[model samples]
Structure formats: structure tokens, C-alpha cells
Target chain A: MLERGEVANSWRHERWDSFRLLTPNWQSRLPGHRYEGPDPDGYMTMAEVTAFIEGFAARSGAPVRTGADVTSVRRAGDGYQVTTGGGEFRCRSVVIASGACNVPVVPPFAGAVPGSVEQLTPFDYRGPAQLPDGGVLVVGASATGVQLAAELRRSGRPVTLSVGEHVRLPRTYRGRDVLWWMDASGVWDQRFDEIDDLTRARRLPSPQLIGTDERTTLDLNALTSMGVEPVGRLAAVRDGRALFSGGLRNVFSLADLKMERLLDTFDAWAREHGRDGEVGPPERFAPTRAPERARLQLDLRGGEIRTIVWATGFRPDYGWLDVPVVDEKGRLRHEGGVVDSPGLYALGLPVLRRRRSTFIHGIESDAREVIDHLATVTLAQRPGA
Target chain B: MTTVANGVNVQALLDAREALKGAPEAAQFVWRASSKWQDGVHSTTRVKEFFGLGQEQEHKSEAVFDADHPEVFAAQDNGITPIEYLLIGLASCLTAGVASVAQNRGIQLRSVEAALEGKHDIRGILGVDSDVRNGFNDIKVTFTIDADASRQDIEALVAQSQKRSAVFDALTNPTDVTVEVA
Candidate 1:
């Protein structure tokens, strides 16, 4: 991110603050802290998360089982029995956490490109170091876009990220994590069942702040600083080059100017909203934009980029297990926290109680509700005593 | 055949796929088979290419065997057989999902198994079919999630597996198959 000009002003300051955090871990009477993302908010670190999970498991007495291959599960009269290589273990409920990617979305044109044209799915992505260095294009533009573009740029790879519409947020605001508001405000709290799936999936306006009360950024300046040109959406991938849409009519330099103008427009809007009593100013603000259906086509196409990172986001896969809990389009069917199947349940799913159901922070709250329900349902299933 | 749904002339995709031609070009992946699972099952078999970037090629091969015929057998690559590899991947993926979710959820699973059955209407594969169902109709995966998890739990597991398995993604989310004669 620092390489890509994505750091903006916030990153510049964090670079120094990072050393301060390292001091704590130095055993200076206090614990040494790794200021994980230059974000000053001190959101729960990986260590904290691990500790929490360990505590929860110890409290619940659920023995941690790893790499145990379970063959099947059948009903044992009132309860259930599970068969695994680790031997049979009984459980009242289950939370299937098989991450989505059930199927590789093998694009049709993948083979159309020359054999030399390397292809990889986000599913296969490990890191920027692994990519065959050439001007690279990343296709999707959801959370994956901003992060991948920043990482690759730092690695000194001229990278282009092709993003569709997406929701953007900053790392912090008013000394608090942007996630704080994203969760508290209804912006990320709306339930998926409350709206149509289309509305649920697309991006929307948000109060999520960016880096500590410092400065914020959009992708425009970031890609340019790393010499990672921004090309339009990929139309087709040929042998040596990929065909693209938008801004091809003019010189590539003109494209960069367009990004600047868009950022300027975004800042101006934020200022206006701040004054208008609409969206208030955060202790800090991140450069961001909500996909405007109107200005979208009208907005001048920005500079040409080499690759498109499909950070466009993820989709759920349900092809092997046969259950009717899924609806017409193949997503699980559930009302709020209740699932379609009896003695079966799901939680921490995207858009469950609200749009935030899928967010990292929201998962904690969702898990609480789910575990509670599981306890209740398990007791209910006990032979109508 | 075309049908109307939601007032749109929806080409029956399943039928169109049935009508769709398989690989217009004849290409194959032939490996030397060492031992036979089936006696008459040709020690050497062929994989017909249905679509996407490959030369118009025919595959043929001989069989290689270990010292003990009854002991073990392996096929040496004539070349990369993408389809065969994909089929194996699909089967493996479905089975893995079944097992993983079962364990994570605390479901006592005795045995989880899946069988892959591919359906490629001859017309679709040969490009002779006026009706399209170019790809396999259904890759049936019968998940024998042991007998432990209730029929309900097992069924849900199966559904979750099917819903979450990536192999199924490769199958259902058919990538655009663009072909050009270079």
C-alpha cells in the first residue's frame, strides 16, 4: 500500500507510530503490541482473536479436533452420533465452515488466451510474489481489489486493478475503527431478508472511516504512485495483450487525470454533505465513493491498467450436499437467524441479520446468537420427555 | 426448445446444453495404462476434447505395468489430460466438503462418499445434436455420510456440501467456452 500511494497522509504517520507499538512488545512493563494495520485504533489483534477462541473453547469444553476425517452422521434415536477417523464424537449442533469456492469459476476465455497467458483464480491466489511478473491485471474490485492493488504495488509490480462497483471504507475515524460505525450504524446492519438480493449484494453509501483521524484515499492516486496504470474493464484477453473498454479514445495520460478529477469530486461531495447535515464528518475521513448509477456511465473512464483483480467479492457454493434449505438461486434459505432445516442452523452468514453479518466484527455478535439458539434447539430435540 | 419465464423467452439452458455441441475439434489425452481395473477395459483409453484451446489432435497409447500385475498400476502422461484431471478433482472436492463440514459441525459422521456420473449427450459432444445438453446432464454425488448423522442431518450436510463445494462450482458455473482455430 505504501508503494502504491495508497497510504496517503495517514500511512506516513503510521510508519512512525508502528515503532512506538513495537516498544510495548519489548517488555517495557507492558505487552509489546504489533500495530497490525497502521490503523491507530488498536482493533483486536490476531493474538487477541486466538486467545478469545481458546478461552471460548476451554469454557465450553469442546475439545479441539484437527484434521479428523468424519465419514458420516446418523440419528441415534433422540440425539446423534458422528463417525470420524478420530473415532465417533457426539455433538448437538454443527457450523459448517467450509469456505466458499466449491467450484472454480473457470472462465470460458481462459483457454482462449495464449498458453503463455497465465491464468489464476482468486481461489488459487497466495500472494503477489507468486505472480509471473509482467504488467498484471486484477479483475474484481471488492475488498480484494484495494488490498491486492496496494500489496502488489508495494512489491514494485506495475499492477492494474479492474474493479466493478464496490463499497469503500477507511481504516479508522475519530480515533475509532471505521468498523465501529459500520456496525453500529444501520449501514452495515440491515438484514438481507429485508431487501432483495440485488440490493443486498451491491455497494452502498457508508460512514466507514479510513486511516486514523489522518487522511483517507481512493484507488486513483494509489495505483499511479506505483506506476501501476489503471486500464478499463477487460473485454477480452488476446495472446500478447488484453482488449479493454473505456478511455481508449484518448491517450493513457488523459486517464490518470480522470481519476484525479473523480477524487476531487468525491472530496467535494463529502464536504457538501458534511455542511448539509447529511453525512457528518468523521474525526477522520477516507477517500471513498459509492457507485453512482447515474454518473457511472457518464464518468470519464480513467487510465489504462494491465490487470483486473476480481476482488469483486465471493459467492457461496452448495453443490455436493443435498438439502432444500437453499432457495431458487442456490443460496441458503433462512429467516433472520432461523434456517430452513430443523435440528440445523446457520450463523455469521453474509446478510443474515443485516448487511454486516458477513463482516469480521459482526461475526462475533452473530456467533453469540447462533450458539444460544443451538443450545435451545438441542434441548428441544431431547425425546419429548 | 424455447420456453417463456417471467415474460422472457428463456432458452431452456438445460435443453440447450443438451443440444450444444461437445468438442467440435477431435482431441484426446492418451496415457499408457499399466493394470486393468476391468479385464477387457482397454488398457489404453481416450479423452475426447469438447471445447476450448487445444490443437486438433487424436490420442493413442500403449500400456505400462509394474512387476506384479495384481499389485499396483499407474498411467504415465502422454500429455496433460485436463478433463480427466478435472473429473477427478470434482469427485474429490465433493467428498472433501462432505467430510470437513461434518467434523466442524460436531456431526458424528461414519462414512462420507460420493460417486461422479457424467452425462454428455452424444450430439453435444459430436456437435451433431440439434438439441443442446453439451455437458454432462448431472454429476450425481451420492454422499454416504456414514449412518450416524440423522437422515435430516445427513441430508442437510449433503445440501451444504453441494451448496458449498467448488468442484460443483466448476460444473454449474460453466465458464464461457470461446474457441478459435489458430
Candidate 2:
């Protein structure tokens, strides 16, 4: 396997802070034996996680060519030409595990926010200590946005959060974890085809939940009450002034409605299955108030506003692949990770097959399917078959 | 050549800008409104709005704003409350700013959504606490703009609009007010 960075799971390299997996421990996600380590509540730091993967790789004796950044992959005679930073390797088939979070989607405003005001994406962010001393504007209030904003606020810096439309779910609803409830509710088992709006479903932002010391939920309301300035959606920036939208009320309303519906669904399911004890009582709904400023323009030039961290999420970049399999929107069009371009395949894409397809626990099924397809195709093309 | 896209007339805007540049006095405008107290917490403000300065034709329109409360305060359940009117005024002004900016920039916007929320502590208004302010402690304006342009582009447009907006300026900065028997 050709690895792009020096280490496995290169995305986690820049992340200096400690975090636990959204789901359970390594043992549950990765197939096979047991993880005979400090399995304290399943949550672990990046260091511990990387060590586990390295140990797995060592045990399996997998020939991983690290630092091999694949520049392009083109079709050869009967195989494929995999060009990389180091050199080239001709292979029969390619399993593209580049993962979705390959490129950070920084909005255009980052460029205009004055050279003095530092702009950092989640990919570039290390920790709070690395930032300049001043108020920070954390845009795109999803998983990274809320977490980073909280972390920074804890670090003794004022944080202004630019909220977005996101799915809000409590980490622990009843006695059990929300993930457990979702699994029991057959949410993960839901297939891509079963979804009414595939595009919308596929593009759904991850639920606004945090799994740090424990599974905790964070939303605009929580953040605002916690002293974090929950502003409207970031609209524009001109002449060192950051402009926020006037539709914050609607944003809060939508998020609140989603949360209500989600909890209601879970409640109904619990009642039907006689798991009422497992489901907790209803949460009091308090919508976030939109600021009075119809258009909020914060002066970034004054130096009070130092850093602008964009946690707007990421989109996969498949530009390196020299194949005609990419769609107009720059996404790989595939049927369960198996593309129409014979030997080429894409794995670890969200909504590839099931809901958990792109997740750590879900990638295995996608990989298996791709491997099976590759094997079948290879066998059919064999000389004496 | 100036381009026109969203609801903005670029040529007309350019002409206005040129007109303002040639004669700065013509750019000045004044808006007037008269209000009468009905009862407790109830007042009616009559607005015969007119567009002044540099225009060949005098434009006029009539509008009314009635402020009242439900059971909370001692007033008949009438039109939207005064604070609500303030929010509406701010919302409408900003929304106009967004539309103007989008149009001026030639952004083919799919939809423009704007909302305003104000946080208030009634202690100051009721004279329960001397420290508490009489108005909204903080107000938040949120917008969800679906446009062909990038998020940054739209944001920049909004910022420019805020800097240029009359209502935005009036609220953020204090304005001199004079009261006398008329």
C-alpha cells in the first residue's frame, strides 16, 4: 500500500489536541482479536490510535511504502500505472482509500480578511497556544467548529462562533450512548438507495456532538450560554470587516426542529421496543436568539480580531487520478465503491453503500466489496480461466 | 460597462454614484415620521415616506406602525410591539443591503434569507434595576444566502452594505434627538 504522508491516517497528524472516536473503541471498529492495551472507555488520543494502527501493520507484515504520494493513476495495458512522489508502480488493480476529508473547504472570505488577521483551516490548526492573543472567529459550526471554539474559550480567549445549519444530537440521550441508540434504531444499516434524497442525505453535516472526556453535545445555544458569541452565518468580509447574516433566528429554529424530530423519533422507537428506560426524558427546547444587528460587521483591522479558523468541513479531491470516472461535481461516481472504469475503485466514501460506509467501522465492508469485485474481474480476465 | 444580475441596476447605481460625486449636496436626504400616544404602551406612528434629494420626481408613500402588547403589559392587543418594529426595521434594512450588494456584484442569488433576534432584560424598563439597560442588551442578525458566488464573496458584499447602510449606521452609532411641544 502506498501511503501519502510519513504516517498512517495523515489527516490526524496536524491535529495536536486529544480526541476520542465518535463511535466506540478500536476493537469494535477493526475486525478480529482483542486490543490488549489501556482500553479506558474506548476513547483515545491520536498518538495511541496511530500506535495501534502501526502495531496492526507490523503484525500483518503489510508492505506499506510510506511517503509515496500518488501523483496520478492511469490505465496501462492490462494493469494500472500508479505514479507517485518517489517513483511509479504498475499494479493489476488500485484500491483508492484516500478518504473523504482530503481537502479543507476554506471559504473565499479567508483571503479578504486582511493579511494581519491569521486564517487557519482545521488541517493547519495545532492548538490554542499556537494562535495570536485575541478574539477568534470560528466559522462553520459543525463538529470541528464547536470543539475548537470550546477549546479556545477554555484556553482564555474570547470566541465568536459563526453558526451553520447542522444536525444536533445529544451524545447520551437515555442511559446508553446516542450511537448505540442509532445502531439499535437501524440508522447505520440504512442503505444509500433507501434514502429519498440521496444528494441531500450524502451532504448532511455530521451531528453536532462532542466526545471528549465524555459524550457531550454542543450547539449554538449551548455555546452562546457558555459565553461564546453565537453570531449569524458568516456572510462576507470587506475592508477588514466581517459581515454576518441577519437570519440567525431561522438557523436556530431549523436546528432546534431537527433536534426535536430526532429525539421524538428515538422516543417513539424506544416505546415500541419497550426500551423506555434506555431512552431519557425530553429535553427543554430553548432556541438561540439572533443578535439585533441585521448585518453584523466586525472590524478585523483593529487587531482585536486576530485569527479566523475555518472549520467549514472538507471535500475529497480526486484530481490526482488520471481516470474519467469523476462526476461534474468532482466526486467519484461508483456503485458500492466499484467504479465503471474496470480496474479503478474508490473506498471510504460517505454513503457509498450504507450510512456507516465511510466511518472507521464501516470502511471494512466497502473494502471487502471492492476487493471481491477486483478478484472476480481479475479471475475472469485470466489466461486459462 | 456595468453589469446587471440579481435585482441591482448597475448602470443606475453608477449614474447615482456619478451624480453624488459631481454634486455632494444632492446626495443628502432626510426622512420624517410623526407618532401619537394612544394609551398605555400603545402608540401610532404615521409614515408618509418620501425619497428626497437629486430626484426629478417627488416619490411618496403612506404606512402606519401600531405598537401594543398582549396580556403582559397594559395595552390592547394591536399591531407588533415597538421592539418588534425595531427588529423588523433592522431586518428589512439589512435584507435590502444584501439584495443591493448581490445585485451590484452580479451574483445570481438563488434565495436570500434574513432573521433578527434581540436579547432583552426587562428589569431596566420596569425600573427594577438601575444598572440594567432599557433596550436590548444584544441583538443578533443571521442570514442564509444561497448564491452562485462563494461564501467569502457574499460576506464581503454584506460588510460593504453594512458600512453604507443608513439604518445600520443609525443603530450602531448614537443620533442626536430633540423634543419640544408641537
Q: Using alpha carbons, what is the TM-score of model 2?
A: 0.67
Per-residue alpha-carbon lDDT of candidate 2 for residues A116-155, written as tens digits (9 for 90 to 100): 9889898888889999998998998887888889888888
> What docking grade applies to model 1?
incorrect
* Interface C-alpha root-mean-square deviation, candidates in order: 17.6, 11.3
Clashes of each: 85, 22
- Model 2: residues >4 Å from true position, as ranges? A26-28, A33-42, A278-285, A288-295, B1-182
Q: Which candidate comes out best when scored by TM-score?
A: 2
| Model number with the top DockQ | 2
